[model samples]
Target: MAALSLALTALLAGAPGAGADEPADAAARGPRLYVPDPNPDALRQVVDLVKAGQYRDAAGVAAMVATPQAVWFGDQTPAQVEKLTRDVVKDADRSDATPVFALYNIPGRDCSNYSAGGAANTAEYRAWIDAVARGIGSRDAMVVLEPDALALLPADCGQDDAEGTRTAARYVEVNYAVDTLEPLRGTRVYLDTGHPGWHAVSSIVPRLIKGGVGRASGFYTNASNYQTDDANSWYGKLISSCIAYVEGGGDAADCPSQSVPRAEAQAWLDAHVHVPPSRMAHFVTDSSRNGQGPWTPPAGKYTDPQDWCNPPDRGLGARPTLRTGDPLQDARLWIKTPGESDGLCLRGTEGPEDPERGYLDPKAGDWFPQQALELVRYANPPVL
Candidate 1:
């Protein structure tokens, strides 16, 4: 008990409202996004680069790999998940820092794409979520639940049952996760909202409502995508406003989208809603690779843009932090681990090699040495 108290003290010491006026047991006031275990492949790359006397390259890689970022939990059994979660929390407890977890095991996750694979069914998914909750047990952690779960539904991807069984199952699965995880005293749950580039405000607001956004801490954007921070903040604000409108007896269909002029959208919100920032939902963004603000394929180049796939020359964006000045924008995070691969992108080519780079790309979650070096070299704030 004494040790835990000391740990909590250390964790809260630098937090806002932790002065003499506040109670020692008060919850930390600001963003507390957790940084999980670093990817081993990234570490190995660092070592290899250093051994080859690539000192500048080694420093750049180290700048990214050494930072604290969210840990991902996906495609693991219940027992394996429980142990991993416990280990992360245990480490956070020792270090006096919060932990962030990306939970990605919804049934039919990723729309059967390159990162395809999830729990076999809703039952299996619930058991997996249950195990994750048990592992968390009341620890202070941020949970980014199920990337692409709502955005790339089974129906949207042509993977759904003709009778809508799979679509219905998807909603149930997300709501089940919200119901299960949100009740934990110290856990903050955020639903995935694709990104600014993909879903419009009018479209995703209803999905978030049906998927239990009200019960969650907030929704996250740009999870494993490369959209700029300005775009993401705009998208998130519009979504939060739309949610407020819907909660106050307005229709989501009436809300403006990213397509609308910024002034017009704000004017529409101003005319219709009176919700305060404190009352509305908050959001986080994955600024992992938005430094260059998304890749644009050469015009008339390919049938499919595949922009989200590993684009060449993308850079790291803002570093991870909870102290974002905007009240509605909670934090800018490295939700998509930098230096990780986004699958072998063919980019409308016939061969296995990527036409954009003239090389065979790494599979999802694998390390790409060339891309890793690019990220470090072009990091937005500069890795060095």
Candidate 2:
């Protein structure tokens, strides 16, 4: 999972270019979805669709698309990185869209795996952050600051690394990212909080707090993992509520309970699902390939749940965007680029390539070319 950190560079594919400013009130502006552009073919396809007046279709595709790119470990020179960002932003400007930014290069990125790469050290990482923040070029943006960096800190998969210094370093790195990007004109940065399925409310809340969730727009869930919208919503709400309760002087353990019967939980979740866009501020979702929702393994599939490893028949989920009905919920985004390999399942490395037969192509970022082409054909036949 740490391998995901390598995507920071790929994720920063866009900075600023053009777009109408959102209304002062985000709600009045309606639900604004973001589409990150890294793959040119996919970007052009969506742009063409939007240009053709297919807003809903475009939303369906771009809403939860993730363009989080490779940064820390790869050999992305300044010029190359800038070009990628410019290209993505250029396309976004033409499409009148804002790309969701996923900043995942925390110090111990991927814990020394193939994706285990960064700016040589903390100081270098900070400088890289500065360039990344600047590359955003003062444009309209929604950012997810570091994926598993916080979730997997001292507790999760992270190494204690040097008498616990690594743990402290992670915090500093996150704060720096928040501090750097928060001041940008219209950027909203959400720190990482492992999906509800991954961490208990108490467990995540503390980590988020340390990771600067309080200062950030909010914390994010379900990056590169398969959690249903219902699940994600409840997880996010519970975490948000827990944060609110703790901040308001409630006991950490007494925040709330989501372990009632499934029916009861769903009922409670339904009643509280729409917290209004204002309350949420802004949250993002990975609509890359969750349409059919998460994948479930058949009998005798594997020893461990195959959720982490790629499964089958999963379609793209809700589109990613800033518009959420619940006042508390901010933006819904595709922080995880779809189609990008979720790492070689066995080796734990996510490549930028796509698989021919699967939920989404691992190579094409998040654009489902096959699916998109089908829509294009349905909407407009070849002009013979």
Best by TM-score: 1
Cα error, residue 139 of model 2, in Å, equals 2.0
Q: Give the top-scoring candidate (lDDT).
A: 1
lDDT of 1 at 208: 95
- TM-score against native, each model: 0.91, 0.69
> Each prediction's Cα lDDT score?
0.83, 0.57
Local accuracy of candidate 1 as per-residue lDDT tens digits, 1-384: 454344333322322211121134537534344555567776667666656768677667766765556799998999999999989988887766678899988888788889888899999999999999999998888889999998888889898778989999999999999999989988888998999889888889989999999999999999988999999999999999999999999999999999899999999989997999999999999988888889999999988869999999999887777767789987778888888889989987885998899999899988888988998788887766
Off by over 4 Å in 2: 1-95, 257-282, 299-301, 347-384
Task: Output the lDDT of residue 247, model 2.
Answer: 64
Instruction: Give per-residue lDDT, candidate 1, residue 356.
Output: 91
**By summed lDDT, which 10 consecutive residues of candidate 1 come out lowest?**
14-23
